[model samples]
Each structure stands twice: as structure tokens, then as C-alpha cells.
Target: MIWKTIKVNFHRLGSPPTFYRLAEVLAPWLWGGFAVCAAIGLYQALYVVPPDYQQSDSFRILYIHVPSAWQAMAGYVVMTILAVIALVWRIRTVEIMAMAGAPIGAAFTFICLATGSLWGRPMWGTWWAWDARLTSMLVLLFIYLGIMGLYAAFEDRRKGARVACILILVGIVNIPIIHFSVEWWTTLHQGATIRLFSGESTLHESMMPPLVWMTIAVKLMFGAALLDRARNDLLDQDRRKGWVQSRLGETA
Candidate 1:
């Protein structure tokens, strides 16, 4: 039954008409959620939240920095999963998702590092540090770039996807190392942000609400971005197919 279900889905997999219909249903909802959540998050962070005692306004960067870091890693994790699926199933759409995810993850990593540096200058008295966590994150950004480059290198796109997928799986070992380095080694990086195991936050309560809201907004934005990018990838890959042409005609 499972194998039959897989076969059925695989047969319909390249049907751009079906995928485009699904994309149409998702697009509006994704964009709408993004707009509403973004506005509220920004308001909550900027106006409603109080300043941090230690870093004052500088801590406000955490609203952006932390979430960007979280999503950057999250994006890569999704990308890696998609890559594995593509390799195992030889699914073109899955490969496309991995392709789309790399740049988005790279963008998130860039934001995290930039905002982190900005925050560091005010708080740590240094704009740049060679700390384990920071270094590992930097490596993660490079991994994203590497995967994208690998995806583009081979003349055969499928071959490229497979190779890139392997690389992602290998590079993922660094993510756990990055997360635990601060705990294992005495590092400049701070501890957990939303630690449930701990009774209380190291941060002030006034700043927590906006930070939480902003994280939610970031997550929503990432989801919307992923959906749009995946749709674009599907369209490109399916252009020569009958369903895609039919859908194009229907839209026209």
C-alpha cells in the first residue's frame, strides 16, 4: 500500500498543473500571514518592548539576530532533507527545493552574522570575534554557498543535485558542533535564548515579547519565501511538460 501510494504520487509528481494550483492556494495565505505578522512583530519590538539593561538599545538587534540565526540553520536543515529525498527518490521537485533553499539559507546566515557583529560592537567591544560559535556559523554560510555552487557545476543537473546533496549531508555535522561549542568550550558566545529547561531567561521580560513575536514573524517570512521559491523552481523545471503548458494556457 505504501509503495503503491508512492508510485501514484510519483506519477503525478511532474504535473505542473496540480503543483501550480497548490501554489496558487498557498501564495495568498503565505503573503497575507507575512504582512500581518511582520507589522505586529515590528511594532511589538520597536515601540512596545523596553530596553535591555546591559546593552540598552543594542539588545534590540537580538530581535533580528537570533531569529535569523535560527532560520538560517533551519533552512539548511530543510535543504539537506530535500537533498536527501532527491538523491533517494530522484525527485526533480525535491532537488528544486534544495536548490531554492540554499540562497535563502545563505541570506539568513548573512543577516545573522551582520546583526551579530553590530550587536557585538556595542556589547562586547569588538565587531568581530574568532569564537567557536561565530566561526562555525561562518562556516555554515560557506556551506550554503558551496552547495549552491555545486548545484550549478555539473552539466547534468541531476548529477549536480546528487553531489550537492551529499555535500549537505556531510556539512551538517558542523551544525551540532556549533550549537554545543559554547557549552563544551569556554567561548564568547552566549548561552541559549528560549531555554525551557532553565527556570528563567537571562534576558529581561520586557524585551522577551518583541523578541518572541519577531521570531514568529521571521519563521512566517521564511515559509512564504520557501513556498514562492519552490513554486518558481517547479515552473522552470516543468516548462517542457504538457501539464505546465496546459496551465500556462489556462492562466492566459
Candidate 2:
């Protein structure tokens, strides 16, 4: 019964109007959640949590850096799922969503790289290093740019999305590499301080709260951004359709 309900909703979401309406309704809520969570997280990270003995206030950067890095990878994973559904089911809405996610993911990747560099300058004595983790993250950024470029290259957006979906699938390998790079290679980047599966965390309990709050904030932010972009893409793609015309007429 649950599966049937989910199946019904999934099909309904494939309808452009339905998806657009859903995005419109949900995006504002997501953005609100992001704003609230980010405000709390920033407060806790800056004032509530004590500085690290070794790194001092500089380590606070991790509150932003870690979440951005996680969301960058998480956004790609969302795109991958959407891409697979798009390829297999030929769902137009899914294709639009998959394409729309690239820029948001790229933004997070840029933040990750930028913050990492800022954190590294004081710790590693260099602004940049070709370390395994850093190098793989840089590659991830390039992959995101490549996906965006490929999608924009074709005049037919659907055809471009199909080709880019293949690239999205191919890019999945980099996610695992990024996750394990610290373990696999000697990099300046630290290994996981908080382990989910093992239920072991090297980080102090007090420092964990900000990371938790910031991670949720970014996830909410990503969803909000994705839905906003996807809705715009849908409107642009379906501008000639009667439903879109009616929506525009109503809005106007």
C-alpha cells in the first residue's frame, strides 16, 4: 500500500505543472529552515564553541568547510539519482532537475575549496597543495563545470541533458575517491573526525553541535536552491504550453 502510494506520487511529480507547483510551495519553507538553522549554527560556531588548542579560531572555518564539502558531494548524488531516472524513464522534469543542480553543487564546491585554502594557509604554510584530497576535490569542481558547459552547449535542452546525464553517471567515481582520499593517501587533509557507521568520533562533543546544525542548514539550502532552479527551468521550457501561459497570466 505504501509503495503504491509512492508510485502514484512519483508519476504525479513527472507532470511539469505538478512539479513546478510543488517546487514553488516547498522552496520557501526550505529556505526558511536554512535561514534559521544557519543563524543558530553560526552563533554556536562563533561564540558557543571554544577554540581548538592547536588551531584556535582558525579551526572554526571547518564549520563552513565541512558542510560545503559534504553538500557538494551530496548534491552530485542527488543529480545522479535524478539522471538515472531521467535516462531510464525519460522523465523531462527529472532531467531539468538534474541539470539545475549543477550550478548549486559547483557553488558549494567553490566554497569548500576556498575555505579549505584559507584554513590551510595557516596550518600547512601554503595556500594550496596538490594533496590527494585537495586534488580530488579540485577535480570534482572541474567535473561540475564540465557538466554545466556540456548541458549549455546544445541548443536542444533535452538532448543536452541526456548527454550530460551520461557524464553525471561517469562522475560518480570521484565521490568515493574524495571520501577515501585521506585514508588512501598521505594528505594534509584530516581523516573523518566523526564516524557514522562506527559510532566513533574524535571530535569533542561540544564541537559537534555546530557541525550538525550547519550540515542540516546546507542540506536545506541545497534543496531550496535546486527547487528554485528547476522551477525556472520548467517555466522556460514550457513557456509555450497552455498551463505555463495560464500560470504567467495569473501571475501577471
Model 2 agreement with the true structure over 1-252: per-residue lDDT tens digits: 999999999899999999999999999999999999999999999999999999999999999999999999999999999999999999999999999999999999999999999988989999999999999999999999999999999999999999999999999999999999999999888898989888689999999999999999999999999999999989988889999999999989
Task: Give all TM-scores, in the order shown.
Answer: 0.89, 0.97
lDDT per prediction? 0.82, 0.96
Best by TM-score: 2
Q: Which regions of candidate 2 fall more than 4 Å away from where they truly are?
A: 1-3
Candidate 1: regions farther than 4 A off: 1-15, 197-199
Q: Please state the error at residue 86 of candidate 2 in Å.
A: 0.5
